[model samples]
Each structure stands twice: as structure tokens, then as C-alpha cells.
Target chain A: MKAQKFWPWLIVTLGAAYFLIPLLATFIFSLRMRRNEYTFDAYVSVFSDPKFYATFGYSLSVGVFTIIVGIFVVVPAVYFVRLRMPWLRPFMEFVTLLPLVIPALVLVYGYVRLYGSSSLIPFTGSILGTDILLTCAYVMLAMPYMYRAVDNGMRTIDIGTLTEAAQIMGASQVQIIGNIILPNILVAILSGAFLTFAIVIGEFTIASLLNRPAFGPYLVGIGTNRAYEPAALAIISFIITWGAMGMINVLGRFAPRTSARTD
Target chain B: MPAFLEVQNLVKSFGTNTVVKGVNFAFAKGEFISLLGPSGCGKTTILRMIAGFERPTSGTIRVDGEDITHLKPNQRQLGMVFQAYALFPNMTVGENIAFGLKVAGMPAEQRRARVDEMLKLIGLLGFDKRYPYEMSGGQQQRVALARAIAPKPRLLLLDEPLSALDAKIRVSLREEIRAIQRDLGITTVFVTHDQEEAMSISDRIVVMNSGNIEQLGAAHDIYNRPATRFVATFVGQLNTLPAGVLAGTPGERAIRPELISLAPRPETDLTLTGTIADLHFLGSVQRLRVDIGGTLVNIDTFNNQTSPLQRGDTVTLHLAQKDLLTLGA
Candidate 1:
């Protein structure tokens, strides 16, 4: 019995170590100023650079903006398909998950063809060349995760009952969505928000393809410029992503415990 | 009071299956009516239709003579307690109770006052701040009831509200529900599969079978004079004996177990002489399975000063003619 349990855990531990080895090496490399001599020089130098700060701040703002837009677009769309037009569920789910199936770089290339200068979508000419394109691409990349999270959350409750309950109490559709449905699935939304942040913050494919001044491109640029500084930046990005996921997991634990009502 | 809520030929179907077929019933003001039946007999479906959760395939539903078949559940001002209680987990007990009123856009002060009133009414006055997960099943059901009633809806619909509870809790909460319904004098529609529950709490019982109303009337009439074979077997224990029209009616002379007497006394109108094949000795009553020719008849007798009969005993079973109901095709 002991061996049976230990074998699976040992394999998992080794699997975790395999994925984490480069991250550990990057952290150690960031800490060292010279051969095996530890110092905080790389971190201080990276923090002092305005370019690094700009990229970090830009990532945070883009993460927040992408999530807000995604929630506004996805929550009602998902709730509608789930509750009202159930016949369209499988189709809608397929469309939403299509983004995940296609490579992010391929979609970003398509975005450039559709919205770049002398492209089909003329309205793209009004916005700045890369920033708008980048934000829109980020929205596309985050669609599958955000939509599934909200959809799963909405599925856990009697959407009809909650809506009817709110309606009977004299709430409009907007109020029902905001007050009752959203509050109940707040945890799912939070998890989705963090997941979106992680994907956008460390996302390489779209940022590299678009050649935008985003965190991923900046990280790559730093990696080519100074070895230790790039390692420090990578560790910082890892910690940010880790922190977001950790907060999400803590709330996720309470979700099932409270899901009895939804049932 | 006249019928405050009237349903006319309400019908619903799914694909080829008709779950509720042309059900028409009405409830007077302050009446507690139970829609009782076995599983898949359309009891819950009827309740859902009334609550505006399910749209009828045909016919009309009217509350106070106004048609409401097209109106949404919330639009109809109907408060419903689902089988699972359907309490909001994230909200406090007070907030759950106050949800309807809050949706009604009542002022904070008025809603607070109404929540207090409801908490007292449901016997959970001190549990306002507690969430639904903190409470037991029975307690949660009570909160659901309190929430349904708090808004003072024009009608209350309870869909198998006590079915999830244990036996003891079921009885107590049922009584509590009936008491609250009585005190408030609200016209309430309750659905349940348990016949005893329907008989105990309802002023009228609508017994359904196979997507149709089998028999409906006062509980006494439904149990004592069941109109169909389905109802007879469904409502209570009944004993069947085959007799080729040695009788008045074709499906005549079927005796209920409770109405069967062991001895043929002067008051007995019908008598059957048979050999007891088996005997079951219950504390209060003895059930004797007797062989009458090729047919087996069951007779129930109350344990009074009478001695217990043996399995092989030959006896004459007596029954009142009035207790036997003749079913027709």
C-alpha cells in the first residue's frame, strides 16, 4: 500500500522538478553577479530601468482591460446560450474553443492581415497600429479560458430559477445579471480573471508575432540584451503568475463547499 | 371564498410523452391543495406549470380571473419552494428571505422589517445572519418557506418541499408549514408523492396517474372511495377478490384492508368463507391472507380483545358493503 501511494507521488514530484528545473536555474542565475558569487545587482538594475517598468505596468493594465472587456462580452453571451438558447450550446462552445485550437501566432497574423494598413477592416486605421491590434489579439487568446470559466460557473446554478427569483423581486435583467448571477459565480470569474492575466502576462506567441511593445516582447528583448537581467525579469513574471493562480486556488476551494445551493 | 386561482385544460408534453394532460383545477382563497401522485404521474409538472416554470402546450391559467399562462413566474407574483429548497448559498438567511422583496425594489428599512417578520414567522428569528450552508436540511427548507412567504406573494407553490427531510423532520416541518399557511391564509399549492402527507396537510387532494387526474376531492373521498384501480392501489392497501358477476356491478365488491372484519357479525353485509393461508401479526392489526377458492383475499382486523388466528384457521371474513368501491372502465 505504501509503495503504491509513493510511486505515483514520486513520479509527480519528478514531473514537477522536470518542468521547474529551468525556472530554478534562471532564479539562481539572476542572483549571481559573478561565478558562484550571489548578489541582487541584476534585480536592482532591472528595476531601475524605465523600459522594464513600462513593460511591467503595460502588462498589468492590458491584463486588467482585457479581462473587463472579456467579462462584459462573455458573461451574458454564455448565460444566454446556457439558459435560453440551449440548442446553440454545442455550437457556441465550439466557436469559443476555436481560439484555443488555432495557434495564437496564426491568429495574430490573421489580425494583421485584417486590420493592418490597406487591410479589409478599415476602422482599424483609426486606432494606433499595434496596441489596438495587440489588445484585440489578447482578447481572442483569452476567449476559451474566460468563456469556459463563466460557462462552467453558470452551469452550476439554476440560471432560470435565479433569474426568475430576481425578476419576481422586480429586478430587471441587468440587475439580475449584476446582483444575483454575477455575485454567485464571483469565484469562477475571479479564477478566469487570474487565468487571463497569467496567459497575457507570459504570452509569447502573439506578442512576438505582432512585434508589439508588450511584456512578452520586452522579456525577449531583455533576454537578448543582458543575460542576468532577463533571468530576473523572467523570475518576476513567474512570481506574478504564480501569485495570481495561488489566490484563485484558495477561493476555488470554497467554491464547491458553497456549490450545494447552486445544485 | 370562491376560487382565486383557476386552471383550465392546462396541458404540457415532451416529444411523444404527455406529462400533464388537460389538468383543470381551482383553489379558493386561503386553501391548501396538494397535488399528490406516484413518480412520473405529472404532479410536479402541474406545480411547475402553475409556478410559470413550465409553459403549457395548450389551455389557460388564471389567477383571480386574469389569464397568466404567458406571464413569467416572477411576473405572476407566485412564491415557490423547490424540492431541493433552492436557497441562495452566498446570501445570509435574512437576505435569502428578503430576496423577493429586495427585487420588488422595496426600501431598505421596509425590507429589513419584512425580513424580521418572516424570520419570526418561520421560527428562525435569530438565524438571520447565517448562510444556508450553515443550516440543516429541515432548517434550510424552513428558510426556503420563509423566503417564499416573505414577499407575501399572491400564491405559494411548494414542490415536494419536505421530501428531502428525514421522517421525523418531514412530519414536523409539514405541520409547521400547514400552520404557517393557515395563519397567513394564503392560497398554497403543494406537490408530493406521499399520500399520507397529502391527506394530513391538504384541504383537498388532487390524485394523478399517467398524466391525468385519477381522482380528486376531499382527502376522505379520495382514500375511501377511490375512482380508479390505480388510485385504489396507490392511495392505500386494498385487497382484491375475483367474483364473476355474482354481484351488482362488474368490478364490484373489492374490500379495503382496513374495512375488513375477521368475524361475520350481524352488522356485516358481505361474508366470505376461506382458509387462512398466511397470517401477519402486527401490533395493532392482524393481516390474514386467506384462500377463497382459487383466489387469495387479504383481511385486516384490529387487535382488541380478539385472539390471534393461526395460519391454517378457517374463517368467515366480513365487510361493510359501503366500504367497497366498484371501479369502471
Candidate 2:
């Protein structure tokens, strides 16, 4: 047994070192702003910067809007697809994965071309319009995760029977979707929402090209100029991402067990 | 009296396949009716049409003299308990029961009171805060029934609500369902393939086959005097023997196992000589398979036999002419 465990343990140690070594180095370097002594001055500098709060707050709001748009767009489409047009599932999967297959840079360029100042809709002409465009792009970007999560949730419970039962009980379509469907799949929605939020927060290319003062562009701007504070910001982003993951695990435990109901 | 709910010449077709081929039936107020059939016999399709889930390809469904063929499922004021007990997993038992009432704009306090009353009706009085996933299949099905009926729907449709449960639970829950239906006096339409279930609880059964209703009558009538061969065989165990045995022409005749016995009837003229092929030792009943002239006939007798029967034993089976049913031509 000891000999059998040798290679597996070595591989696990190597993998752990691969991830932890850089993180440890970054933390050590981030604490070195006050030369010859380890200090939290880098963290304090990052906290002190006004750009940090503004860009973070902007990105957070954009992430929230993207989640909202994604839910409103992806959820119903998934519901209808799962219930009525199950044959369209392959097509939906292909469409949702298009964003991942085609890089974010390519997508934003296409968006700029379509919604430029000279275009009929001209979404990039105003700040609000540009923000709307960016949020819409984020929703599309997060579509694959949102759809898969909601669809997986749908698979757990019988939407067809539940919808029929609700309808037979005099619930309208909206009532069934709002009162019956959403609550059952809430964990799935949260999982997708957190993923979308993380993507929006750390995304670099789209926010950069769109000239939005989001956290991604701000982080890159800080990284190119400052070393210690950039490392601190990366650590903060890491925490935020991990925090979102923790929430997912916690919420996932309560994901409406498809338990005794199916029996 | 006119029917409280009427399905007039209902026909449903799915693309190239006709699921319900022009069927018609109706029932009085407070009637417990069952649509009984094998799978793919359009019983469920008919029930769905009545619930407004599946619109009939032709014909009309009217409840209380209202032509509800074109109405949406929600607008029809019908309560349906699905076989899978489609209770909302997110909601607790109380919320599930109060769902319809809430949708109909019932106030919170009133909804709570109503939910309690319904929970009490289903004998789940204090299970208000329990989510469905924490309950058994029977409990979830009861909650589903309560949810379907909380709004005081004009009609109740049960699409094999007990089919998903264990046999013992199915029997007990079915009794509970029948009791609740009687108390509520809601006109109910139940669909199931299990003939025993329909015969035990329903006031009338519509025996369906191949998207058509073969027979419709009271449970006793359907069981005793089936109008068609399909009905005769489907509703209960039927033994088809040569008509010459009954002294009626040259065709076949149908007989129920219960009607045949080892002991003679008061006027036992018809008789057959057969050797016991197999014997089933049921607790209170003994089922014997007797082979008479190369044809095996199943007969049920009370376990109290003067002399116990075994395989290869010669026995004489006696019956009356009235017991032999000459089924439909």
C-alpha cells in the first residue's frame, strides 16, 4: 500500500506546489513595499486608491445587471426548451457555447462594428448605451453556464407535471414560472449568477476595449504600473472569486433535493 | 338530470397518430368516474382534454354548461393530481396547498386558514413547514391533491395519482382519496389502467382501448355484464370456453372464475370433468388451474375444502347457464 501510494502522493504534492508556490510568492512580494521589512503598505495603498472603489463598484453593478439580464433571458428559454421544444436542445447547446468558442475579443469587436456610432442603433454613442451594450455582452458571455445550470435544475424536478399541476390549479403561465419554476431552481440560478459575477469582475479584454472603468481594466492598469499593489489587488480578486465559490457550495447543499418526490 | 361535465365527441390526434378517436361521455354532479384503459388507449388524452391541457382535435368539453374547449388550463378551474405527485419542491406543504388560493388572490391570513383546513382534510394537519423532498411519495401525492383542490375547483382530475406509490400505500391512499372526494362532492375524473382501483372507488368506469371507449357503466355492471370482449377480458379475469358447453350455438362463451365452483349451484346442470393442473395456496382463497380436454380453466374456491386438492387430481367443476355470458358479436 505504501508503494502504491507513492506516485499519487508525489503527483498531488507537485500539483499543490504548482498552485501554492506562485500564490505564496505573490503574497511575500506584495508585503515588501516598505524595503527590507515585510509590511501591509501595498494592501493599504490599494485600499487608499479611489480608483479601486469606483471601478470595483462599477463592475459589481454591471455584474448584477448582467445576472438579471441573463436570468430573464436564459431561464425562460431553457424552460420552454426543456418543456415544449426538447428537440431544440442540441441547437440551444451549440448557440450557448458559441461565446466560449469565439473569443471575447472577437465578440466585442463584432459588437462594436454592429452598434458603432454610425450604425442605426448606435449603442456605443452614449455612456449609458455603451454600458447597456457591455452588460448585454456579458449576459451572452454567461449564457452557457446559466443555461446549463438551469437545465440541470430542471432535470431534477418534473417541470411538465409541475406546470400542469399549477395550471390546473388556476395558475397562469407567469405565475407558474415565477411561483413554481424559479423557486425550485433558485440554487441553479445562484450558481450561474455567481459565475457570471466572477466573469464580469475579472474580465479584461471586453471592458478594456469598451473603455469602461470596470475592475478588470483597472486591475490591468494598476498591474502595468505598480508591482506590490497589483499583487494585493490580485489577492483581493482571488478572495472574491473564492468567496463566490464558497457561496455556491453552501447554496448547493440546499438545492431542493429531488429526493423522495421522484419515488 | 343533465351531466355536470360532458365530453362531446372528443377527438385528439398527434400528428399522424390519432390518440383519442371520437369518444363521448358525461357524468352527473358529485360523481366519481374513472377512465380505464391500457397504455396508449387515449384515457389520459381524454382526461387532459377535460383538464384543458390537451385541446381536443375536434368536439367540445363543457363543465357546468360552459363550453371550455378553448379555455386555457388555468381558466378552466380544474384540479389535477398527476401520477408523479407534482408538488413544488421549493414550497413547504402549507405553501403548496395554498398555491392555487394565493394565485386566485386569497389574502395571507385566509390562505393560511384554508391551508390548515385542507391539510386537516388530507390528515396532514401539522406538516405545514415541511418541504416535499422530506416527505414520502404518498404524502407528496396527498399534498398534490390538497394543492389541486384548495381553490375549490369546479372539477377534479386524477391522472393515476396512486400509480407511483407502493401497493399498500396505493390502496390506503386511494381509500383516503375516495373519502376526501365524497366529502368535497367535487365531480372527479380519474384515469388509470388498474381495473381493481377503478372498480373499488369509481361510481362508473369508462373502459377504453385503442383510443376508443369499449364500455361505460357502473362498476358492478361493467364487471358482471361487459358489453364487449375487450371489456370482458380487461375489466376482470375471463375464461373463454366453447359455447357448446353452455349449449349456446357453436361460438365461444365467457365466464368469471368466481362464478364456477367445485360444489354444485342450486340448479347445477352445466358441468365439466377436469384434472387439477396447479393449485395456488392463497391465505383465504385457493386458486386451482384445471385442465379439461386440453384447455386450462382457472377457478377460485374458498380455502375451506372438504378434502384438499392437489395437482393430477380429477375434479368436477359445476356452473349454471345464467353464469355463462355470450359476449358481443
lDDT by residue for model 2 over B1-329, one digit each (tens)? 88899888889999999999999888999999999999999999898888888878999988999999999998998888998887888889998898899889999999999999999999999999999888999898898999888999999999999998999999999999999999999999999999999999999999999999899999999999899889998888989897555454478877899889998879767889899999998979899999988888999998875788889999999988778888885
Candidate 1: tens digits of C-alpha lDDT, residues B1-329: 67798989989999889999998888898999999898999988888887777889998988888899998766888888877777776788888888888878799999999999988888888999998877888888998898888888888888898888889989999999999999999999999999999999999999998889988899889888788888888887777766552244454456677777776667778777789999888878777788887678777778766565787888887777666677655
Every candidate's fraction of true contacts kept comes to 0.31, 0.92
**How high is each candidate's TM-score?**
0.91, 0.97
Comparing chain B with the reference, what is the TM-score for each candidate? 0.92, 0.97
- Top model by lDDT, which number? 2
How many residue pairs clash in all the candidates, one count each? Answer: 2, 0
Give one digit per residue, the lDDT tens place, for model 2 in A191-253.
Answer: 999999999999889999999999999999999999799998888888999999999999998
Off by over 4 Å in 2: A261-263, B243-249
Best by TM-score: 2
TM-score of chain B of 2: 0.97
lDDT of 1 at A112: 71
